[model samples]
Every structure is written in C-alpha cells, then in structure tokens.
Target: MDMGIEINTRFGRLGINTTDALIDIKSRMPVVEARSKPPRVRIDTQHVQVSIDQKQCFAEVGLKPADVFAKEMAQKSRSKGLKAIADIARKGDTLARVDKNPNAIPALAKGVMGKRLDYTVAALPRSRPRVSFSGGVDINWDMGYVQLRAATSRPEITATRAGVDVYILQKAAVDIKYTRDGFDTTI
Candidate 1:
C-alpha cells in the first residue's frame, strides 16, 4: 500500500512519492518572564529528515544547548553519557544529511522564479544556543512525477572554511515522468 522514489544527494537523502518516514521531536524549553508579563516557556520542534548515506543506515538529529536535555546535562548524567550513541554514528550514515551546510545557510527556498531565486539556510549559531535542521526540504516539478537520480548535499562548515564539505557534486539525477489518468489501450 506504499510506494516511493528516493534521491540520495549524498550528504542528505530525499524521499518522493510518499511521506512515511517523516518524524518530529519536541522538547520543553525554559520559561522566560518579563516584569509585567506572564511566564512562557519556549518549545522546540525538531523535524527529522531521513537520509540514505554512508555504508550503513544512520540517523542525524539535534538538541539545543539551552533546551531541557542540554539544560539538565549535569543532572541527567545518564542521558549525557548516552551521547556516545551519536559518536558511534558515522558522518554520512544516519538521517540522510544533517545541515549539509552548517554555515552556508542553504536558501530556505530553491527555485528559479522567472529570473530570480529565493532560498534560506540553516539558522546561524548564537552565543550559547544552536538549532536543529529538521524541516529542511524543498520540492519542484515540471508536470508529473520527479525523481532524483543524483544527490545534492549541503556544504558543511568550520571556522576556517565554507562550502568545503559540500559541493556541486554531479548530475545527481536524470529523468522526468508525467503521470496521466488517460484510458488504457485494451489488448
């Protein structure tokens, strides 16, 4: 009852034709109160995008430093110790490609609007907080179904470099199919 087309942009993976693999992780944030306003705690919703990378099937998710988990790092000694699990995950193995361009700020949008384009990148790191790149997906079509033959991954970043880890890899995909509800030719 389920079918799908997959595109492995190397660093991250994309799923077409179905939405069975999407996941959302929510965390309780701290409560901020103003002198005259009521206290409201922040909430984080991390969207997990699955990717087919590396040699093994791996996952890539995130947690902010000020969130509940990070806030209780000292108290949740057991939870903090379990972070080793992520250490065991090879770079490209899990959850498709997480924040391909950790600093590149992949335009949140990817399309040629006539002669212009608009996009967004992952949120930048702040003084003491970070964000998870969960809802990182875009889609387009020429008419019918579109499948990716190649993978276009985001560029990873570091203090000394940008776009070093990710690049315009290659012709990640090739082919286009347009589905129609036309009558079948009787044999």
Candidate 2:
C-alpha cells in the first residue's frame, strides 16, 4: 500500500471603504428699506397798531375876553364923530357962532376945543366864538414767516457659506487558516 499527505489553505482578501463628499451653502437675499419723517413747520404774526394827538388843536381854537370890548368901543367912537360933523353942516354954522352960543360950549371945555385933548378909556372883559382844528396819526406793521425740517434712513444685508467633509465608515480586515492530513499504520 502506498501512503499520501494533503494540505488545505485559505487566504483573506483586503477590504476598501469610501464615503461621498458633502457641501453646504447658506445665503440671504438683498434687502431694501426706506423711511421718512414729515416736515415740521411754524409761523408767527403781529397785529396792527395806531395812535392820535389833538392837544395843539384845542389851544389854537380857544378865545379870551378883553378883545371883544376893545372892538365895540372903536365902532361907537367913529359913529359919534360922524353925527356931530353932520349937525354942524346942516345948521350953516361957523366955528365963531358955535363959540358964541352958550348952549353949544361947556364951561369945562370952552378953551380946550382949540387945543389938544387927551383921555384914557377902559373896557370890560368878555368871551367870543371861534373855529379851529388839528389832527395827527401813527401806524406800525410786521411781516410773518415759516420754518421747516426733514430726515431719512438706509438698508442692510448678510450672507454665509460652509466647508465640505469626507470620512470612512468601516476598516478593511484579513484572516488566514491551514489544515494538514497524514496516513497512519497500525501494528
């Protein structure tokens, strides 16, 4: 009989692992905003004014007493002189005849007629009516105006981006095994 030996063996294979790359992006849209304030205004005004004066008018128009009496006396004296002259002319009398007449000449003024005569006259006081006027006025004025103001504001925006990452999920492994076979003889 012939004897024989056999051997069995197995080899493990290497394993590979892979993962896909990842990327992330974040963004914000551009924004536009506007704001405004209403205009502010103010105004001012002044009233009209006036003034008048009349003192001077009163002083000029007023009248006093003694002036009236003097005017009356002058008119009376003129009339008396005219009457005496007319009587003498109507009678056809000469100055010599008048001197001779006892009734015509007064004892107190007999010699004084041919000479200068002087006399003093007195008058009474009284008020008279008169017309007068005066007037004056003053005026003032002021102008008005307005004031105004305004304001405004601007807009804002933001954006962001993230990085990519890659990693393995499992590791590769290998295993080896061997077995031997032999023939046996018995006594």
Candidate 3:
C-alpha cells in the first residue's frame, strides 16, 4: 500500500519524471510563495494530500522515544549498550569543548517533542536558513534519540503478485493543513 510515508509530511507531490536526476534537480519545485510559511522538505512523494501550515519533521508514532530506545538497546548486548552510551558522551564532550557552549545539549535538543519535525520561513531573501541537526535531548540522564529507521509504506507494495502476503502496519498520515483557528469552526 502506498500510504502517507513521505518525509516532512510534504506539502506537494514530487513527480519523479523520466528525465535525468540532475535535470529534475535543476527544475525548481512549485513553491506556495507565502510569507512566514511553515517548513517544507521535499521527500520522494506518493498519493497523499498535504495541507499548508504543517509542523514537525517526523510523525510521532504510538511508540514512545524512551520505549523504542530501550528496545533497541536491549536487542544488543550490555557491553554494546554501554559502548553506545560512551560514544554519545564523547560526542557531547567534543561539542562542549569546540563551541565553548556549556548548554549545548540543552539548547540543541528542542526538536523532538512534536509530530512535525520541520519548519521553514524566509528569514531573509539572500540568506538561506536551514537546520542541519535536530533531535531530542535527554530529559533526565541526557539521552538522545538519533538514527530513525521507521518503516514506511506497506509490505503489499513490495509483495509479488504470484503469492499472497499480509502486512500489519498502521495507515499513517500526517495532517498538513494546520490552522490557528482555535475558536472558529467555520469550515
């Protein structure tokens, strides 16, 4: 099934033409051209409708970050988990030394709370504002959720026609048409 699995919950569909990838890259995407618009990232598209004013970079699943992390860590040996934790700590220390920012982790971790994981606005016409690194910070013990490997699309799409296959994944889609009409239900 071609479900809503595109990245950033896209605002428009990206039609992959028969042309070369470079040629397609040269062609600019249709922009909404609105001032103070929401963030938009162009991932490979599918048959899904996206509304404007969307937020967040990734969809928040029924699975919690803590739970997922624990499960993943559990799959590995105790020594592996310890090593991973050590690696994270080393990276943190490196950042602290280089940037001279004591509160680096605390400040950099304001990205992982919402279902949407991206936002964009014309900060300046000449200046291209971009957020390269964003993630959730450790609330208590300074843990971070990195490396997303969530399954997108269904198994049926990948299944062969000769045999019958069953997929037990949720039909997930992010509502892109976010509005600030808290009180007005005049739609």
Q: What is the C-alpha lDDT of each candidate?
A: 0.42, 0.48, 0.46
lDDT, model 1: 0.42
Tens digits of per-residue lDDT, candidate 1, 1-187, equal 2234544443434433422343344444444433333344444454676553322111112343355446566667766567646544533343245455553223322211234558877543323323334454344333333333433444443332222233343445545444455655656
**Clashes per candidate, residues 3 or more apart or on different chains:** 25, 0, 9
Query: How does model 2 score by TM-score?
Result: 0.24
Better of 1 and 2 by lDDT: 2
Over 21-112, each residue of candidate 3 has an lDDT whose tens digit, in order, gives: 22111233343433343444444434444343212222122233666658766776787978879868876676768557666666446422
lDDT of 3: 0.46
Give the clashing residue pairs of candidate 3, or none. 39-119, 39-120, 55-116, 56-116, 56-117, 56-118, 57-116, 57-117, 57-118
Q: Is candidate 1 or candidate 2 better by TM-score?
A: 2
In model 2, the worst 10-residue window by lDDT is 122-131
Model 3 lDDT at residue 3:
28
